[model samples]
Target: MRILIVHNLLWAHYKSSVFQALQHLVDQQADLSVQVLQIARNERSRAGLETSGGETPPTYTYNYELLFDRYLEETSVRERTRLLLQRARAYRPDVINLTGYYDPAQLLLLIWAKINGIKVVMQNESTAADQQRGGWKERFKRWIFSQCDGFFCFGSQAAKYVIQLGVPPAKVLLRKNAVDNNALRAVYERALPTRIQQQQALGLKPNNFVFVGRLIEAKNLPMLLTSFAEATKRSKNGDTWGIILLGEGDEQTKLIQTIHTLGLTEHVILLPGRPWFRVPEILALSNVLVLPSRSEPWGLVVNEAMACGLPVIVSERCGCAVDLVHHGQNGFVFDPDQATQLTQQLMQFMDSAVDMEQMGKAAKQFIAPYAPEVVAQEMLNGFIKITN
Candidate 1:
């Protein structure tokens, strides 16, 4: 089997699942050749083009920015179409996989593939309701869906959304984002050693709640800060509970200001965003993980936290909350936008450290089956069913 993956970039620190999936396919060694073609807005500098290993799969690049921003008015839609057609002819891919937000390139390639009797599959996170906002973009997306042989969605909600867009239910597949359980097991095994070093370095105590992910409106950081502040105030053991906010984004300055206004300087600690490799170290240092997002299609970090044997408090809106969390059994799920609910959930974990630990252990067991390799195999099975 030969597969071509079309995405926004070849490598991104946050998109580890994609890398794991592609790597799993290559590791199958079933006479499979996987090529990754990235359509990016920025050109990679000399320093940015280094490969991790010699046998990495996937190769192709089409700079959308070069066609739009660099050339100004020179490149036309017809020229863009011609370029993509040329690439399709050269690669002659058995199957083309599309990822990320919709792009003109995806539409063009899918249309061309349909005409050439080639298989095309689109994987995206957008819900059906999101496409109902009447506009040229919605119409364009509908047209794109018409050209694809199958659709891969992040969860059942997204699969339902895609089916609502006129694709047959049989053609829509649900594949959740997964954690690298092998890596997670290694991290958990070394947790004690890493935690000792992390505590020594950061001056963090044994009991602290950690929040990871981008600081943004969609993440509902303001509500989280407020809820944590309230939880600390209402706690019987004052100063016993500590909150660590990790990752950086557009909401950082505003969230910092809000933290100060609420007099939560001592209770909340802000850490700069670290690379993916260092996340396990951070997760190991904390007792509980919280993801308060207003609208999370799926919270991959929650799975990672659970895999590392930490209790998680995720928003009800998160897709992973539906499958991963069994309230009071593994972890808790609260209304992300509601300060009181969020505060109550956090207090539940903080009030009893022993119960939290037991739940954390349960969390690890809950998500053990949905490992990256297992998820990748499911994805391959889905692709084969759709193509056949």
Candidate 2:
């Protein structure tokens, strides 16, 4: 069966789980031919420009900037519709999978696919309660979903939402976000030594906490910093722990100011973000990982941290919290906006080094079922069922 996958290419960074799963399916199913059609708005002009011992060109992926540009500048509704129709005619796919976001591309693609007699499957982000309201946007989304052969949701919450959106319960498929465990294991094995060496170079002691993700309001970095400050006040001399913030964003200057004003200059370290491959090493060197996001559909880094055997503290708003994190078991879950809860959780981890180690072991065990090959097969089976 020929399956044509359509999604914004920029999602490639965190969506490696999807790509890895697709590759796994291709490897296992001889009859399956997969084609990825990325409806990218603009190609990177700087992608292959430099080759010497020169500065590295900035890497671009699916992010706010790219998504904004795609929607605002490069393509319009009519042009995008035309492009999808063109691609569909050429590919002639048995099954067309549409990934959901606020973007119009997926919706347009689904509409065109329906008119052309192709089986369409839409994967969306709505969770139970949010599905009940069918505003104009929701109505349009519902129209697109109703015409599809199947609807795929990220979790039970999203599946419930799809049902609320007026989709038949049998049409909705629950597909959870997954990690590429074998690839993650390989990355962890390779990064462990490098992380230790880097820690020595940076003068960081063992058992420090690390936070990964963009420094945006949604990530709640300011709240985390404030909570860390409060946690430090209750600690002995504030020298017992260190915190590292990874990833860059528009809020860097404001976050820096908060660190300085809070007098946490000595404890907090800001490291520029590295590629996904370098993350396992960073997690291995840390005693714990914290993702204090105000709102997150899914926190992929939580799975990455768990794969590295590091305990995590994630916000309750994260979609992955339900499946990946178990409070007081693998990791703790705190209300994203509640600094006191975050501080309390931090103190709990800091209080006992033995407890931290045990939690880390539990985290690793918790994520063992989400190996890339396993999740990929599940996705492929879903695709097969839809197309057949």
lDDT of 1 by residue, 192-303 (tens): 6767677657866557888988788888888988888888888775477677888877889998899899897866788877544457767877888888887777777887
lDDT scores of the candidates, listed in order: 0.70, 0.72
Clash number for candidate 2: 1
Clashing pairs in 1: 35-58, 36-58
| Whole-structure CA lDDT of model 2 | 0.72
Q: After superposition, how far is residue 58 of candidate 2 from its true place, in Å?
A: 18
Compared with the true structure, the alpha-carbon lDDT of candidate 1 equals 0.70
Candidate 2's error at 16, in angstroms? 4.4
Which candidate has the top score in TM-score? 2
For model 2, give the 10-residue run with minimal summed lDDT. 57-66
